[model samples]
Target: MNKNIITLEYRISKLLRYGVMLAGALMFVGWMSMLDFTQNPLLAFHDYREVTFVHSIGYAWRDKVWGLLTAYAGLILLISLPLSRVLMTAILFWRQKERLLSGIAFFVFAALIISFSLGIEL
Candidate 1:
């Protein structure tokens, strides 16, 4: 492998690791908050699943549901990590003059975006 590719791989590895750690930390804080809020060691599925993303964010800010907000933020971060990797792959392939690989990477990225958008309801 090229030195540049090796370096890019290292950077991508770090990005994934740090992203997961940050998300895990946020989730841990959210879990602890939930425990406090509910005064129970175990949580029910309905506790966190009752609101949509927009509503959870609003509740997090306006209704002081910090746990829900933090948890959702963590989930969003987790979901975006793979997308970020795809984006980085495309950029690196372009920089290395690998046109075909770059094009494929871009195609995959576009497909992911389209699928995600399609999954959302109006």
Candidate 2:
């Protein structure tokens, strides 16, 4: 039982580490590619505008802006990591019959969902 728990924890940690690494790599690639793009960085900064997420995604796609797309993907993955981790933990705890821990994990997962879904930007 002890060894099993250790192995499960190791696996979970490994998953999280790999997820971070992947997200970092993607962001790095996107940033590097953005540097190589034709736009002048200073000019882009001067023309800064706020756009909704859906509009940004559509523009990135329509304009064939691979770097922006890659960067956005990485950002999304990085942002979602914690939520995924919590959900995974909840599932694993439930599977292991850890009633209290599982309940806590599930409650946390729900809270995260609610926060993201219904959270107000102040």
Candidate 3:
């Protein structure tokens, strides 16, 4: 095979892999948010009364914490999401390097999933 052909093959393979990763990340987020967190407002009371994490935060700090979480969650998704795709494209040029992009994508994906599942809309 020619040198140019091999390079093209590697670039294509890298792009395909990156696309798969990004799709997986998005699907994972969507799956997590499929719950009925918003279907009942009473669930908030339950969370406050029952969930240990919610109880630990306490009602006083709930709004503030929720605000921060919402802001960051939206920001992360808006930023990391497009960045993930762009970085994957960049990976082609960078030669299949998935370290940094994968980590950022994972974090952003998790944040998006949690925020969506908890009915935190922005």
TM-score for each model: 0.82, 0.84, 0.31
lDDT of each: 0.85, 0.84, 0.53
Better of 2 and 3 by lDDT: 2
- Relative to the unseen true structure, what is the C-alpha lDDT of residue 98 in candidate 3, on a scale of 0 to 100? 56
Mark the regions of model 1 whose C-alpha exceeds 4 Å error after superposition.
37-50
RMSD of each: 2.6, 2.7, 12.1
> Which candidate achieves the best lDDT against the true structure?
1
The model with the greater lDDT, 1 or 3, is: 1
Ranking by TM-score: 2, 1, 3
Query: What's the lDDT for residue 69 in model 3?
Result: 41
TM-score, model 2 to reference: 0.84
Q: Output the worst ten-in-a-row residue range by lDDT, candidate 1.
A: 37-46
Q: By summed lDDT, which 10 consecutive residues of candidate 3 come out lowest?
A: 67-76
Candidate 3, pairs of clashing residues: none
Candidate 2 regions off by >4 Å?
A: 36-40, 119-122
Scored by Cα lDDT, where does model 1 land?
Answer: 0.85
Clashes of each: 0, 0, 0
lDDT of 2 by residue, 46-108 (tens): 776888777888999999989889988998788789998898888888888898999999999
Candidate 3 structure quality by residue, lDDT tens digits, 1-122: 55864777687677667655665665555445434566773565575444443453464265554543443344445445454554444554445455676566566656655765676322
